[model samples]
Target: MLPPSVVKDRVGRTLDRMTSQNIDALILFSREDIRYLAAFDQACICLVIPKEGNPTALGLWLDIDEARRQSWVQDTRGFVPQYHLRIGGGEAQRRRLVEVLIEKGLSRGRIGIERGLLTLEMFDTLKSGLPEAVFVDATPVLKGLRIVKSKEEVELIRRASEIADCAMEAVSQITDVGRKESDLAAEAEYVIRRSGGEVLSKTLVGSGKRTLCAHPFPTEKTLEREDLVYIDIHPSYKGYHSDLCRTFLLGRDATKEKAHETLVAAQRATFEATAPGIDPEQIYKAGISSIESSIYGRNFLELYGHGTGLNVEEPPMITKGCREKIDENMTISFFQGALTMPGSYGLRIEDTGVVTKKGVKLFTRYPTDLLR
Candidate 1:
């Protein structure tokens, strides 16, 4: 749970955005947005935040108590499904949400919504329910506000990165020949949970031939003496996420060692280029130039990195043609992965941190040297 002041600050910023856009109220259905504003995480929940006033959260009866305890909002209403009525479950929920908006005096005003998160059926329902209200897509507005992190949010991400470092250390200690990839992944997860962290995504563990595929799930494949192992971990602390990736060589090979060196150098260039007021394109170009300068010049991915926060992947994507500039207090993950050839092997290095005035403050501090 976040501090009440932090929650209030986020809500204030969101409300200001709403006011700027002339939105009488903003209805958040996406779990990430709701959690960011109200700190309420539950299914069948919706948060209605007006331009100027306290927000209201509508949740199921079973979860309303917990929502009240966790959420900063004082007005939490539990929805009682009217099963005996002719209305269906979806209709009932939609009607309840519409009623809330009407009571807030937004029935005939412009209301902001996450169009990307809503299904066509639900969107139609919303439109039909409030015929006089103008619903506009506010995804960009919400994402724009969330791109920057507060001090408390950055602290949580740092703690999450620390847990990721610990988990990687556990992996280093257990990675060896004859060990199953599943076993190593299990060990890492245990370390994260015991260290007061939660796994945000599937722990990526690939070895040998599996390393060729990006985003491969852990399998029963056993480690070999001469194999390339890749691990990507996403750990969260207090709803803030951090991403870390590292590739290790089971046995020494000059070619793989040189690739590792090149990868580290590219990541270093990215870190050096990251700072406030710098175009993200420049940071990406710096990384690409450094990678192409090495012997594994032809091995590069299209995407270098992305912004990180409540969601594992967020806005300000670090890719070609993206014009998003890095700003102060924004947290980003700088990563680069390459495969020398198809079905051969791969190497990657990723680090997460907060952007400072001059540079980035790295959080994941695990050694990038290829583990023997």
Candidate 2:
């Protein structure tokens, strides 16, 4: 659940985006955007037509319960309910959506829709149903609105980080030298659900060298005495997702002291380069340079970190060749890892961080070391 203030902020920003772009009405269907503007959590394709006077949201009749519970609209009781076709093609909702627009004096006004995520088929359906209204693409408008984070949204992200931190702490305790990758991952989810964390990204614990594969699913591979462990965990708390990763070693001699020193140096360099107004490319290079000059080879995981928010992955990536300016309240991750570790072991460490006026705020507070 999200704070009502956050939902309102999102809706207000989206309305401003639509209004400034000269959009007559907004027909929101994207799941993320829908949740952004209104807290609609049902798994149905909903259409939201916002007019100058009144705004109407349309969804499947079956989702009325969920829509009512989630929507933060002040007058959702006044919203028109329409039933969607089970076949996902033609729906009674489409006709009613158009009819509601016509009633709201939008017969000749432009209807805005998120174009990037919507399909051509849906566009055809909307156009066919509302032949009188002009359809205008609103992808850029919505993105521009969402790019800046409000204080409420920022608080959600911070709360999400605390929940993710609890989950990782559980994993740190349960993941021993002999635990299987699958067991470690399953236990991660166990703690998350138990701690009231919403599991958005699938939990994965890659043991030993297998951790090098970035998005590897859970495996039955058993942990080794000298293996490296990387846990990729993303959990949603208060409707905001947290993306965090931690890599550690197992047994008494999991990683050599020299290797640990090199990685610590790299991580420090990356952290030093992180700030509110630093160039992302150069900051990423600061960390990668330590790896290349170390005993390890040139490449070690592709980039440093990506932005984390509603989605685990987002733009404003902290990677080389990215020319975007870093701003305050922009949360990011720093994955200072060594996929190119000598002796064929994956040693990667990641943490969620936020850009502040002075430096980055580290969210995940767990310690990084080889499991013994």
Candidate 3:
């Protein structure tokens, strides 16, 4: 949990943005977006931040207590029975939101909603309730606010990275010939949970032919000698996510060993080009160039990496076409350190880091060496 002051500053900044955009009120629907603003982690909850007054959180009656306890907003409300016992689905919540808007004298004003995340049913309900109010998409406004991390957010990501490192170490110790891919996944998840991290997704443990698949889930396939194995762990601490991957070989292979070295060299090149004011494509091209120079040149994945934060993947994607500049405090991932050869094997090395004045500071420190 972040300090109350940190949350307050975040809301204040949001309100400033709202004022400039002439948005009367902003309603956040997605759990990740709500968590970003209110620190309340309920998918059924909605946070309404008016341009003038304090923000309000609305949730189910059963969740109101926890919502109030966890969220920074004081005017947290819940949908309970007024007469007949009925907590109608999406419509009821939108009706409650409409009433709140009317009460706050914003019925005829411009309201900002997450068009990308909001349901059509809820949008219609609000439209029916307040026919005069104009609704605008607030997705860009919110994305602009969340692309950069606060100091506290960076610390939380660091802690999550540490937990991922521990999980990788645990997986490495237990990975051996005859062990099932699921077995290694279990070991990684156990370490993640015991280290105060939340398992955001199933740990990916791909070996042999399965390594060629993108984001493959762990299976019962048993490891064999000389098999190429990779473990990608997704863990979260205080809603900040860390994505890390490390590849290894069950036995020595000169070609694969050199391939791993090439991947590491590509990662170094990528890092060298990452800094404030540099284009993301420049960083991407550096890795692509390093990999293309190697014998395994044709295995380049089209993507370089992306921004990560409240959600595993977020804005300011590190692709060739993205127009956003690399700014200080932006949390990013170097995920392009992967090479794939269909029907044969694949290898990857990834790390999460933040851009600072000095350079790109990586959080996950698990060695990139091809573990034997």
Residue 107: error of model 3 in Å? Answer: 1.9
Candidate 3 C-alpha lDDT tens digits along 81-184: 43111223545556777788888888898999888776777788888888999999886568678888888889999999999899998888888999999999
Query: Candidate 1 residues 158-213, lDDT tens each?
Result: 99999999999999888999999998899989999999998867898999888877
lDDT of each: 0.83, 0.70, 0.83
Residue 263 in model 2: lDDT: 73
RMSD of 2: 3.5
Error of 1 at 71 (Å): 1.7
Residues forming the 10-long window of minimal summed lDDT in candidate 3: 81-90
What would you estimate as the lDDT of candidate 3?
0.83
State the TM-score for model 2. Answer: 0.84
Q: What local lDDT does model 2 show for residue 202?
A: 89
Q: Write the per-residue lDDT of candidate 2 for residues 241-273, one digit (tens) a residue.
A: 777777777655623545666676787788788
Candidate 2 stretches with Cα past 4 Å from truth are: 1-9, 45-51, 74-82, 85-108, 131-136, 252-261, 336-338, 341-343
